[model samples]
Target: MSLPRARFDQFRLAMMLLTRLPVGRISGAVPAMDKARWAFPLVGLVIGGIGWGVFAAAVTFGLSSVIAAILALLATALATGGMHFDGLADFADGWGGGSDRARTLEIMRDSRIGSYGVLALILFSALLAAGISEVASATAFLLAGVGSRLAMLLALVFMPPARADGLGRMAAGKGEASLIAGTLVCAVLVILAGTTGAFALIGAGLAMIVIGHSATRRIGGQTGDVLGAIQLASETAIWIFLATSAH
Candidate 1:
């Protein structure tokens, strides 16, 4: 295939995998899922954009700050079909309740939401809402949104998988170039917003790495749940950084 066509296909697959965006049909064999992983940030940008737009619209309509913030959060969740949130819930249940790696994986696979999952979702959502309410700016929303996905991409690229086979493996093992490409894209997006965005992205990256290492030690490697958990943590880090620094 021609290079541009290949990249386009990757982007299509990335959109399909990462968001509920109408990417239409994915045609042909997938170009390495790892290569498409670079476009994860683009999916994030769309999700963030939805949040910013909704918040801006809510504020324009004279909604309270808290209400506007919740709306923004809802927009992203709706856009992505709440899949990441689901992953977070599962990871929480598995990690918190399991005594061993095998048990953890088994718990994560169950469809039921346990008490741990419920608490995890609530705590994470509260942090996210607080950040959005405090930052209260579309730029902050966009940066946090994009930065978190970039965090996920970096985690996928650098972290090893706990299991011998799964979605994580297909997207792992050759994510270096993808990470660089993703970082460049993230840099452009963040810098275009402002220098503070650069700092925010760096903060998000650091949080993701820390979480990545923690997940590795706890579970032996990265999994889809780990990636989702990293995204949640990274996004929370971005909002926290912006909230403290937004002045």
Candidate 2:
């Protein structure tokens, strides 16, 4: 395929995988997850735009920033079908409830949520809302959305998948092109934020590194749930960083 066509297909794959938005079918064979990683930040752009729109509309209607933030988060969650949230909950349950790697993976595979999962959702959701309310900038919202997925791609590239099957495995390897493309897109987006961008970068990067290390040690590699957890943690960190540094 030609370069432009290849990129388009990859984008379609990314959108199909990442969000609930119904972009039409890809023209031919499905691309690998790695091939579509380049477009993950683009998916973030769409998600962030929806969130910003909702927040802007709410604020225009005289809603408090707190309520607007909640509304914005709800919009994004609907856009993505709450996939990341589910991942965070599964990862928390698996990581906290299991005594061994095998047991952990098994727990993650279960459809039920546990106490750790509940606590994780509560803590992260609260932090995410609080951060959004405090910063309340379009740039901050977009950065959190875009930067967090960029962090997820980075995790996908750097860490080995914990299981032989599933998304983490499918997304690994063949990622050099994705790494470059995603970094370029994320870099350009970051430049829009000035020093706050730098802080968010550092914060998100550190969160990814920590998650990578922890995932490696606990489960021996990354999983889809771990990637989702990474996104939530990275996004929260970005917003918190922005909230602290915003002028």
Candidate 3:
């Protein structure tokens, strides 16, 4: 059965954003640039829901806080297939070890993880696990996920592409319209959930802007790896904010 045009477009864009699903079929149906521009944050909301549902279920089942947090992280990783983790590794290897832009790009292009990448991944994942464990409510967990993705959007808006090709380039210059739309949708949902998601949103936005600027200068622009790094870093930042406020 054929779907409505608008819904189909959203689904197609979501497919591109969520999974590493090939976009060959829908390549001509819509502009890749436009879809990539809007879909990233929208997919984040879906992923956030998945993470929150798992956390809520765990909480309802009388699970320990540590177990619930582990389950939530597992749910998110399964849903996104650790795409951002891969980005984090690449960014760390490139930025931490390379002596020059060409060298950094080459290191990032390498398929193997390096010492710096391993250390970065370990540290970041440990922090995430700890942060999620501190969340007392499912609402806060969900907001953290959504807020983190919004940070990713902010990164996309402010950071220059590291290269002239790849996913970052397609999404660059797409502007605030798509990001704003996604933000509004997430905001409304967060409000409906009876929590002040506004603070998380503001914190995430500020973190993204600051990090994006520094990252852009460090790498001379954004890359797919940079985008991933942004998500990973922003997610951690959001979680940190939530944890601090929870105290």
Best by TM-score: 2
Arrange candidates by lDDT, highest first: which order? 2, 1, 3
For 1-247, candidate 2 gives per-residue lDDT tens digits of: 8988988889988988989999898877888787788788778888988999999999999999999999999999999999999999999999899999999999998989999999999999998899999887777777888889989988888889999998899888645667676577668877888888889878999988998898899999899999999998999899889888875
Q: What is the C-alpha lDDT profile of model 1 across 1-247, one tens digit per residue? A: 8899888898888888877779777577777787788888877777888898999999999998788999989888888888788888888898888888789888987889999989988998998898888877766876777789888887787788777776678888754777666677677767676766777777787878887887787788888888888888888888877777787
TM-score of each: 0.92, 0.96, 0.84
Q: How far is 6's C-alpha from truth in model 2 (Å)?
A: 1.7
lDDT score for residue 216 of model 1: 83
**Candidate 2: where is the Cα deviation over 4 Å?**
none
Candidate 3, residues 1-247, lDDT tens digits: the string is 2446554666567556655545446634564554456666667666777777887799889998778878988888887888888888998898888888889898988889999999999998887778778864656665666667666766667677888787777777747776776677667756854444565566666766765776666778778787787777777776766676667
* Comparison by lDDT, 1 against 3, better one: 1
Q: Which 10 consecutive positions of candidate 1 have the poorest summed lDDT? A: 174-183
| Model 2 residue 42 distance off true place after TM-score fit, in angstroms | 1.8
Index of the highest-lDDT prediction:
2
N/CA/C clash count, model 2:
0
Model 1 stretches astray by more than 4 angstroms: 193-195
**Of the candidates numbered 1 and 2, which has the greater lDDT value?**
2
